[model samples]
Target: MNFVKRAGTSLRARKARTVVLSGIFVVICTLLLGGFLLQAAAARQEADARRTIGVDVTVRGKGLGPAVADRLGRSAPVNRYNPVLPLKAEARGAQPLESDGPKPPGTRTGDRARHFLAVSGVRDSSMLLPFSYGSARITAGRGITPEDSGGQVAVVERRLAERNSLKVGDTVRVRSADHRRTVPLTIVGVFRDPTPDPPRWTPSHELPGNTLYTPVRVAQELGSDAAAVLSEAVFRIGSPEQAERLHAEAERLLGAGTFDFRVNDRAYRDQVRPIQQVGTFAGLIVWVIALAGALILALIVMLQVRERRDELGVLLAMGEKKRKLIGQHLVEVAAVALPAVAVAALAGQLAGQELGDALLDHRQGDVTPGQRQREPVAAGTPRAAVGPPAMDIGPVVLGKVAGIGLGISLVSTAVPGIGILRLHPRSILTHNE
Candidate 1:
């Protein structure tokens, strides 16, 4: 009889053993599949975290103009950059929002009467820390973008806008503190600032509600010189690990002592670390589960071979080749493995998502909201998914599970069955009796 046909007959004849073996294989395969799914999810989550809370390198120094900042931004590590020039300007026609706090000692009635607004010039207002982190948001029109580099456009706070009856398309005039330069900025956007006023007295320009954003060149034009200069430049990189590469680029461009490059990765550390830890843990789980599953299946197969010694001895006496005996055992185990893989794939999908959510929630809870927001976020970047990493069973994961399952089948059947089938037929039959 053909070995394949005999193997099928043997499995049917020992229905109880086949069922038990299939059950064991199902459990092992489920665990192995779960581990593989988790590893894939962790890797995906880590990549998303890196993209969301990218590293921000702030460069502050003298003469850091748009040209210089643009050069630094062109570096391979930089994804995007924003250069800011901060100024305090007297509101020409609009009212500057005042803090609700009580006046401090030595308060000047004249100072209180003066309307000043905090103005910031930027390549892209949307990339500002306040706007990027959700602390402040544009409520109307559009933010100051790169194309508005030289235009006299502004995006003012909504309160400041309401105070002055300002809206998009309206013009707001601001005079440089020196009073020598007054410029009219076309209001292209209005933003909302949720920051509360200081407990004590604060200047009108320093009030959160009185802030304004404009084009970088507009700010420089209002400064002492016609030359463009920046208060500071912030460059964003994909991950904290890329900070070093960015630093090297900065050092090379600025010649090392000309500027101070500071890397702020607090947000990255707080948010991404949890996902990284999960990835590492998942890797360990995959290895442990694979080894343990293989060992368990190997022992079960060994016991099964021992219990069927008489059957194997008779087959050997009937002139069945030793290799065919082993092949028959391998075929039976492989047949069970195929169904076990299918069942495991189904079970893993249902369980893997819950397991992924549980692991992510547990790890993510370690970072508080305050801690996660401590560092400045890169503006205009899409935020990562707020919940658990999506667990998916793709072809790669299925392939890995299938490969490992085959390995387990081979180890479980070949090793122990080979040793038992090596014994002489007479010795095997007498020993069983």
Candidate 2:
């Protein structure tokens, strides 16, 4: 008989068995596909987040000064590192006095005022992040060049510029505690800072605003007492294990007297805690369901063989080869089952994509409340100083999902087929009698 005829006859004779097996295949495929796709997506998202956030080990010491930062910078194990000293200065500018001032004698039309706080002079290795809070884009200017160090040039945040009504090429005055000096900073670039919500003791806004960038040397020049030593160090290691080892080694060498710092691995782990938990749970569920599916399919196929014993005996008696008989049975079951599995897998992928999106959206929204509370509101306004988080999904992530889903389908199907092949037609036929 032709392969199609044999497959059709076998399935028609065992309608109930075919339907049952198909149902099992569908469940197995769905579970496997959904689990793999979601896990892969979660892993990709976690990795991307880690890269964007970066991993850094900060080394600081009360007595170590900036020299320690410089020393660690030369370490071969270090991927990239920069040292910085936090300095405070006042930026003075003239604002047009309100018209009421014109009535007063000797009242200058432009008044000078001072705004104080902290700034930093960081090494070339340390630069502003390219994107933060979507708002921190380079609009209308170049960023601070390495040469700007020790020069009178500064790069201020766009929000800061708008609030102060300052633009590129404007001259502003910066004052150290002991002396007052005016610096003419050409607006080379404006960038948004993607600092996390709630200012965490960093100089810039919790997200990216009201910040300024200038050459490290220029910062030092503004503050004569400014020490040239590095304050913080960032390193990119080959692996998590290497990062851990390097962190420990650096800490040991510096001793407790040096600054306290953290590794990127720790931050990365903490960031993906939720996704990791979800992945673990999904994995467990898939395994349990797939196991049950394999068991059910095997049992259904075995039982169907028993009910077909008379027919199998006749086929054998008619000179039908045992191997052909087995092939026919295999083909019959596979033909019905594989298509069901494929359909279920497609459905599962769609479901997983929707679920993943919802989970991400919910997580992002949940953080908004805490972010608003921690955001620095400009004086006299309830407006949040924080900007929206950056959420960009690239092609690499989609490719990962597709690969994982295909892998799951092959493994889940092949595993059960092995047992199916080992079935003996003669023994099954004899038992049926």
Candidate 3:
């Protein structure tokens, strides 16, 4: 009979032993598959974190104006840019949102007591920290885009809208802080702001609910200066490493040492570092398990060969090639490994979801206590810092597990068979007798 046929017969003859070996193989294969799935998931999450949680570069200088901001924004490294023009304007025929916190001591009672609305003019309202991080969302109409640069438009907070009975398509007039220029802005959109009042006493204009977003041009018109200028402009880059390139570009545009460039990478470090750590950990697990599994199976096969020396001697006496004898042993081990691959694939998929979630949840919270305040937003933002990765068991992972399982089987069988197969047929039979 062929060695393959004889290998099948041997497996059937020792049903109990085969079952025990199969159980061990299943455990080893399951661990290998799980490790691969986790590594793949971590890689995917890291890529997303790089794109969504990018680095923010803030430029501040005396000469940084609308023209310079536009030039820097068009640089190759910048993903998005927002030039802000902040101003204080009096709301005409409308009421600003009130703060629940206590008022400042001895507040003014007459006309001076009324605070001007806090207005923020931007090139793109959606790129602001609040909207990008998702702490704030648009409720109706559209955000103030670049097209509204010179147009008179405004997007108000939902609370401010309710206090003044304002809605989209309604015009609200605002007078400059110097009370020289009065501009009429049509309400383009209304957004919901979850930011709450501070614990300490504060002015109504400084409150979150009283803030307004408008086109940069509107702010420039309402501003006292004839030229359009901004105190600072924010730019987003793909990764923290790209911040250097951006710095160089800014230096080229605005001259080095003249402007203060602040690079904020807190969000990127908080979100991406943990996922990278997890991916590395999973890789270590794969190698350790693969090595240990091969060593264990090799020992088991060695002992089995010693106990079956009589059968090996008899086969050698029958003129069977020693290579065939080794081949038979290898065929049996591989047969057991073949079924374990499928079983492990199923087991891995079932366990990967729970394991992946637990691992990421633990890593995402690995932030230092001191760094919490420095983060762009607090914990309760709409999007999580690092969401759990999807546990997808793709063909690539399956193929890798299968390859490792078979490699383990080959090493286990070959190590023991070579030692015994070297003996002569007469010497092998005499030792058994």
Candidate 4:
């Protein structure tokens, strides 16, 4: 009879053994598949979590030099840079415009006071500090761009514009606090400040209600501080991990004592913590699942070899080569295992998601609120499902599970097959050494 036919005959004759062996594989495949899926989910969570936090850093120190912004801007972690020069601008002939000169002696609380435009020259609308933080929003015209920093272009607050009768394309006269410097500013944009009213203790002159924005170069000229220097450079990083790595590199470049890095990664850290825990658990699960599957399969196969010692002796005595005998045994096991493994693939995927979510939930304590804002995970959308806590079973996940299952099968089969290699036909058939 052909080896394949003989193997089939052997499998059919030992139906009980086949059932037991196949059942073992079914469980093994399920666990492996679940672990793989869970790991994939955790990785995806980590990536999504990082995106929302956004990499923002503020570099502070003395004598930062002009090129510091350029160098830090090109760093691997930086998404962009926002250079700014804040100043108190002087306005003349404008109603309610903050007075530039010192308060007159004995000015009473009920006395009419003036407020100045909180002038800030910025590299770009996007790079400006207050604008980037959403504290001030432009509602009319356009903000001053890089090209307008020193050309007398200005973006004034909407309330400030209303009080001064200023409109887009109109010119307003501004003088420095020393009253010795003055410039003509053309209105280009109007913005609204949504910040809540300051406490009663805060003075009206301190309000940002009548602020102006210009190019950074303009603000520098406006101050004309004999010793003025760029105090700090702010860089928006790309990711939290890169932020940390780049911080070290930046510290070296900027020098430890000369500068300090303030990275904003609180949201990213909180969001990723739970997913990181899941990843750690998944790693351990993989090892345990593979080892457990291998041990059980090997033990069962070893017992099958011992029980068939007499049959093996007969086959060996009948001129069958040891190698061919082993091949037959392998064929028998495969015949039973292949079908069991195929079913296990489906069974494992069905169970992987629910189990994975349970693990995620156990680890998902109070993280950052941003994690909850994750895009709604939908079922049949792609790799994820629409269920609570998000469970996904995709082709990639199944492929990984299948690969791991195949590995376990080979390891379990080969280790026990060694027992047959040690057997001697004469010792078994004649019951003699």
Candidate 5:
């Protein structure tokens, strides 16, 4: 009989030993697979923390004005500037067609519905707070730019656009609430708000989702005489640590008479704190599992070889090559280990989620709500204010786990196999008794 065939039959015949060893392999494989998945998840979260959290400083005061916002943004360390001008308008060719919200009283069927829109004049509408928290996403066209300043262009919400049958380059005719001014707004972009109805207690602007974003210049030109009194400015910093320094510098450069200087680090902190915790926990667990898995598996394999010494001895004496005899031992362990690894992929997915969530939950309280951190957020994409949470453990993770698990098991089993397999067959047979 072939040595390999003989070894397979032996493993099947020794039910108790095979079961115990297989159980050990399953545990080791599960832990290793979970560790890899957590590590990948942690990496993705840490990488995206900054974008999901958002800008560092938000200066809101009456009449902060575009000039002031622009100047602060151009500050030595500041990367992006957002100027906000709020407007209320009765918009036509802008409201969504599907009627869901309470229509204005006395409205006839087939008539174009008008809405009380909370229009904003922002340098980049994509940088607006709605997009930061994922309440709104820009789904069509391009965002407002500096070159589009003073130009009559607008990006409307998706629901609003669909209701009115509008698309990029279409016109949205906005009339000021008082009817004193009207701007023929051209639709350059469209946005979508997934929430059909926010809580009744929520602000009107956040609920009905009738938001229109226009260039600051056009906003400034069309915004009412009192518009400047309510305008605010937002400035982006490279990291949260720079907020205070930049705030001080901005205050010194432009005296803080009209605007109240406030550092908006809470959002960045809240989103990043848990993500970072997951990363740190994964780092620690990976080293621990690697060492423990290797040591335990190697010790088990060594003991198994000692127990089966007579079998190895007889095979060696029967003219079977030592290499073939050792190969049979390896093949038996691999037979058990291969199935353990296969089963581990399923367990790892569920375990990874639990481990990450648990770690994130535990570490969340590490950083106080008001405390400052120094995480970095790359400032390149003008519109991608916040990155959505990433799912990293999929097909790629499974492939890696399988390959690494097999290699680790092989190494762990090989280390002990080598030590005892070097002994002479006659000495092995005598020691077995």
Candidate 6:
């Protein structure tokens, strides 16, 4: 008989062993593929979260001024520096129109009309990013420039422009609480602040309307001397370790009481800790289960070989080569294993997608009331926010799953067949006694 007939006969005679072995192969492939895919999905999510929140170091101080910014610029390995001070300003004249709506008329209308927290000596490096509202772009306008540092130019948020019916080249009036002088700011650019979530304890929710972006000089011209004291300093560092070192050095140079500085290292650690812990435990469980499956399958294959010894010996006595017999058995195992591996890989992919969605929902649900309560709004109305786009499982992940599953199945079949290679024709058939 040919290899196919031989394989069929052997498998039929060992039906119990074949069924048990196939079950074990399926279980092993399922656990390994599922664990790997889930881990990969989690890693992708963590990376995206880190990129979204990009600040490396944030420094806050009472009496910290541009001088501190200058000193840090000179001393620290800073990629960028952002100096910020919060001050109130009255909107003076006509409201700029934003995509969302028109600015409501009030004491906060026009430049002198709205209450704005002005920044003094705003630097290029300090500008916030993704400066656009839902589906809006920062077209036809220029960002805050260094030459405009001491000038009366304003880069208003897109929503602010839409509400007030303001556009590029329009001028808004601003009044300083400390000084009676009114500053007329010509609109230079319209930008967006991606995060609708404002910092804690700030009034006028929705990223603070009447907010104007002007040069540091314009801000200093509007607020008190104490206003020049930098409220916060932002830095973009090259590496996490570098950020930590800079934080420590900043504490030494600026004095701890002078400022509260934080590095992204701690936040990164906190964010990844849960995922790492769970991944570790899950990996351990998967390993244990996979090992158990391999062991069980190994035992089943060995038992099947023992029961088929007579048939194998007869084949050998008929002049069939040892390699051919081994090949036949391998092909039989693969015929059984390949389908199981395919099913396991498909199951893993489906499970990964489900797990990702569940994780996202759980995270969103955990948002505190305080956090959700303070979301930015335009005209006291909430904008329809967009959800994160769906994740695409590309060929890379699918290929990996396919490769891993096939490899596991092959190893499971091959590991216990070494004894099959040593069987002797005479020893088995003649001793069939």
Candidate 1 residue pairs in backbone clash: none
Q: Which pairs of residues have clashing backbones in candidate 5?
A: 96-163, 97-163, 158-191
Q: How many residue pairs clash in each candidate?
A: 0, 11, 0, 7, 3, 43
Off by over 4 Å in 3: 74-77, 88-117, 124-152, 157-163, 173-184, 191-210, 217-227, 362-385
For all predictions, the C-alpha RMSD in Å is 4.4, 9.0, 5.3, 7.7, 11.1, 9.1
Q: At residue 125, what lDDT does model 2 achieve?
A: 19
Query: Pairing residues by index, what is the TM-score of model 1?
Result: 0.85
Model 6 CA lDDT for position 212: 67
RMSD of 4: 7.7
lDDT-superior candidate, 1 or 2: 1
lDDT of each: 0.79, 0.52, 0.81, 0.65, 0.66, 0.59
Query: TM-score-based ranking, best first?
Result: 1, 3, 4, 2, 6, 5
The TM-score values for the models, in the order shown, are 0.85, 0.61, 0.79, 0.68, 0.56, 0.60
lDDT by residue for model 4 (1-433), tens: 5777888898889898888877877777777666777787777766654543455677777756445666777777765566656666667766544444455567664554444456776656644545544446678888776566458888887777887778898988767656667788788888888765454433344666667777666676677583345656666564666777767767777777677777765434454576788888887998998888878877877787778889888887887777777678667766655676568667755676677667765242222222221121231111111123345666776666666666666676687667777777888888832
- lDDT of each residue in 1-433, candidate 6, tens digit only: 7887777777787798678767766776677666665566556555444443223577887656776776785655675566765566656664432223444444243342224443334665223422311222354487666577667898777677887888899988877775586889998887655545343423331244445678767777777664478667766554465776776667776776667876644434444444555556556766776667656666666676787789778888888887777667666776667677677766665675675565433243222111111112232211112133233455675565456545544555575568778888878977873
TM-score of 5: 0.56
lDDT of 2 at 278: 64
Per-residue CA lDDT of candidate 2, range 264-333, in tens? 4443344446556766766776677656655565566566665666766666666676666656655765
- Show where candidate 5 strays beyond 4 Å: 1-3, 46-49, 57-81, 84-121, 124-214, 219-233, 236-264, 349-393, 431-433
Residue-level lDDT for 299 in candidate 3: 92
- Tell me how far the alpha carbon of residue 356 in candidate 3 is from the true structure, in angstroms, after superposition: 1.2
Ranking by lDDT: 3, 1, 5, 4, 6, 2
Best prediction by TM-score: 1
